[model samples]
Target: MQAKEAAEKLGITQRMLRHYENEGLIEIDRSENGYRRYSESDLRRAGRIRDFIATGFSTREIKSMSACLSDEGAGPCEGGVIKMQEKLEHIERLQADLDARKQAVLDRIEELKQGLAAEPLEL
Candidate 1:
């Protein structure tokens, strides 16, 4: 499959696919004419990378865990495990911060509601 078709199948832009290739996330083949020829495995790998990106993982983070992604249950890779743990910890900290912000917003909304209820003044 070509870059266009593979990107379409992966539900991502062609530029994004190229960027992934450039980031060394997925390896792509070149045709005789020098066009990219993406294979099933490549697309599969792209999908995985896309999913990780959607989950807020950066290319560096994904690259660091590339070893585990390709391992076919051949035991565990310590580097991959450490990278994955770091990613999870980063996500957890972000989530905690976001939750705090959301709670602050909710409290402000409640305060606004109380003030409005006290006096329904003209706009």
Candidate 2:
């Protein structure tokens, strides 16, 4: 498969596939004309990589997870655990900040509604 087909099958942009190649997460074979030829194994690896990225794992993290993924989700990759924990902590902090902003917006909306109710003009 070529870059376009691989990208379409994986539901990602070609640029992202190039980035993954540049980051050493996946590799592609070059044809005689230098076009990228993705193998079946490459596609499978790319799918796993995409899944990890969607779950908030960084490229570096995905690179380190090859062992864990190959092991069928068995334990023993301490680094993978540590990286996941860090991502989880970051997500928690982000959720807290978003929650605060949502509450502030709701409060402002309610204040505006009350002000409008108090100053109703004569029909």
Candidate 3:
């Protein structure tokens, strides 16, 4: 497959595919005429990269994860695991903060309602 065809299949722009190649995420073999040749493995890798990107992983992180996942008998790379754990912790903190904010907003609305009910109008 060609770069354009692969990118279309992956639902990404050609430039994004090239950018991933440039970032060492995926590679393409070159023909004698210097045209890029993509194999089935490359398409599978592109799908993995696209999925990771959609999940908020940066290109560099995706590249690292892919390399780790490719290792044989590595018994599961700990780096990606640690990174995901950290992200999960961060998300938990953000959720706690959001819940607090929501409570504050509810309290403020109740206070406003009470004040409005207590006001007397002469007109």
Each model's C-alpha lDDT? 0.83, 0.84, 0.79
Check candidate 3 and list the clashing pairs.
Answer: none
Candidate 3 local lDDT, 12-113, one digit each (tens): 998888888899887789888998888887877777778778866788777667754342313456576776677678778989999999999999999999
The clash count of every prediction, one per candidate, is 0, 0, 0
- Candidate 3 is scored at a TM of 0.67
Tens digit of per-residue lDDT, candidate 2, span 52-118? 8999888887887776544354456657778778889999999999999999999999999999999
Best-first order by TM-score: 2, 1, 3
Q: Write the per-residue lDDT of candidate 1 for residues 1-123, one digit (tens) a residue.
A: 999999899899999999999999878889999999998878877887897789778998888778655535124755756666777899899999999999999999999999989996888
- Model 3 scores a C-alpha lDDT of 0.79
Given candidate 1, what's the lDDT at residue 73?
Answer: 19
> In model 3, where is the ten-residue run with the lowest total lDDT?
67-76
Models 1 onward score TM values of: 0.74, 0.74, 0.67
Error of 3 at 28 (Å): 2.7
Pairs that clash in candidate 2:
none
lDDT ranking, best first: 2, 1, 3
